[model samples]
Target: MLPELKDISNEEVKLPESSKVRLFIKREDRIHPFVSGNKYRKLKYNLIEAASLGFDTVLTFGGAYSNHIAAIASAGKLHHFKTIGVIRGDELRSKKDYNPTLKFAQAQGMKLHFISREVYKNKTAQTFLEELKRTFGSFYTVPEGGTNALAVKGCEEILKPEDSMFDYICCSVGTGGTLSGIINASKPHQHIFGFPALKGDFLSDIISKFAMKRNWELQTAYHFGGYAKINNELIEFMNRFKAENDIPLDPVYTGKMMFGIIDLIKKGYFPPQSNILAVHTGGLQGIEGMNLKLKKKNLPLII
Candidate 1:
């Protein structure tokens, strides 16, 4: 039998100074080492549907350090399904040993298929998918970042009956599946906030595709550049946040989100005395790979 998922808790974030509002982080990172946080939520139903559909092989796409790639590989291995990872950036094919995420996925028995950026951009094209089917044989397809109807269905489970007390719900947006789920599950009185890790105006449309309500807003200014881009200030904030809150945050997602929540609080972005619950969607597996880049750049690494 699979290990039973424990009750995920909300731990209060210790702000520097007491404010009118209280901030708590939903410890979704503790879900699993490889299949942690939103990745787990996003994949929960997709894997189930794959099994029900009689598929033994599952294929997905992601970049070098994607949490989704690592999580799916781990999940597939654990559940006895074959996994194929179509990794972006053909240049990374030779660097798997140095890339911790890729190395882990390989160790989990996922077959890594490297592709050029040009081809990856057209990954969803019918002809491209047909070519993949011809090359890899019949397999279940999970889109990059794992966003889909089933993914959103799983994410909707993130919020519980007890969580209705919170007036605000916050989560990091990648492909928008998790946020869409939260939006669907949220109480009418609660407001949902999405902090995008990537810089793009197109996310709104993606979210709209899955989201059923207009009770949420995207916090666009906190990306700190684009996806996978990080600076010293972000590194420092993540370190300090860990030191103070005793919570380790992934630089790409959770770290940026925590920074935004606090900054918004300080700027009076939320209504006074509003209760805020920030979802700590996990991507901690990518920290090791990010540190390698930080080392070469002579930058402070995420703690």
Candidate 2:
């Protein structure tokens, strides 16, 4: 809320000589260490609305390593709002110390309520929400991954008039809030592409709920097995990418989206001389926990 607009910069990415299109990545990851990228955009209006409505507390849902949870905790701390994270997998309650994401949230004064995966599936249901209301008592609800009307409104600002020159707008898809915003803000001639981090058909439905344009498509082939699921190939790619680009990518979201975009380019997906702009949605906080898992599996860690 305090003039962070000056920090964002678009860096052109190097491509092979044979490549047909020009590629650039918007360094939204550097916007803020905690509340970075689309998470910051999604929360901007929602937090303001919460304060405007006189809500002192904000509650949201997420997994153990969710970037959304970390951003919310950090945002709450920055804005002086009480935060509650309804974390999935009740088993993680005892393992909180080992999970850096949850630990960071706790350190930021987030009250975490662990729930079973089954119960988390019904998070938006009326009865479950009412039960949570009775428990937490009068808190602003930021839906899982923070996708809501106000959040989408914030996302629409990701693209600007100057960005209209680009032929394509690309970003990682989580709950589809950011993608929907890009789609809504894109120029008529530009196409928006979303690279989903999870495997599912439900995302399109969610994106349609907020998107106001039809110039978008989801590239579904590069999720790397599913949400939070990564292997050696992706780890190696991420490491090599950082070594070359000097830009660190989190394995879950940004890494997969980058991988997909590059792969598509190599496969001759884009038109010749087309300009492509990729949004670097930050999820770097999840890397610590992911590296811990990678250590256990003996997979190469993301650099």
Candidate 3:
């Protein structure tokens, strides 16, 4: 498998006089023309392993507008693997009225299987995965958001010495996969932080068990109205931040992390001269679909 690494320049962003912080973005956002950022790192090892194990097809679970699904589909097509997306949502009665994300997945040749939210929760249940295996024949199964040991290995590659040394690294947590991977790969000197996008209290325990970081720090201040729900302030921040830096920030991932990071910096979370690295997990495709929803509600946008 040929791994493509994108070289991006670090931008030295200035903070307020009162804050006095120097911020540098690693630009994982520019990992690829389509499937970019942490998604590539998360999927690389898994894809290679699947191919090596002689798996001709790949099957995974995700929501109707999951970046994971988009990335998987994109990777499958690019890497010449058959793909199936067991999407979590009901099919619209109107056959022509398809969600944009589902449309994109289908366009990429991803066989779509709709499932109820209740049943979707059982994706990892032994019986369910076995049933899928029987139905689809032998195939590789990646958890939603590409969580696994292989995914963690891919994330570790992102922590090279050439990358800026950060006091703290922050990322949006979905299934606790990316954070868990980063934690496993990070040096003891660097700290890893997660902002849970879902409204659940048990994620800390999940992360603790996954990363073996019994004393790791977990913060829940920035769910911003739960999964996929965004308020005006978040929208405003995404727009303003993009305008100031010209960086694309989808509210679902990077936007929320940026909001939380800024709030943390303003609250004096970091001391003087301390650097922070915020991982930009890519979900830009969902932004187009989100805009369609927000536009109908007259919510303002930047891009």
Tell me the number of clashing residue pairs for each predicted model: 0, 0, 0
Q: Which wins on TM-score, candidate 2 or candidate 3?
A: 2
In candidate 1, position 289 carries an lDDT of 93
Lowest summed lDDT window (length 10), candidate 3: 89-98
The residue-by-residue lDDT of candidate 1 on 69-162, one tens digit each, is 9999999989999999999999999898889999999999999999999999999999999999999999999999999999999899899899
lDDT, candidate 1, equals 0.93
Model 2 ranges with Cα > 4 A deviation: 1-4
Clashes of 2: 0
Q: Which stretches of candidate 1 lie over 4 Å from their true place?
A: 1-4
lDDT for residue 57 in candidate 2, whole number 0-100: 97
Compared with the true structure, all predictions reach lDDT values of: 0.93, 0.92, 0.78
- Global fold similarity of model 2 (TM-score): 0.98
User: Residue 220: error of model 2 in Å?
Assistant: 0.7
Clashing pairs in 2: none
Q: Please, what is the TM-score per model?
A: 0.98, 0.98, 0.93
- True-vs-predicted CA distance for residue 277, candidate 1, Å: 0.3
Candidate 1 weakest ten by summed lDDT: 1-10
lDDT of candidate 2 at residue 192, scale 0 to 100: 92
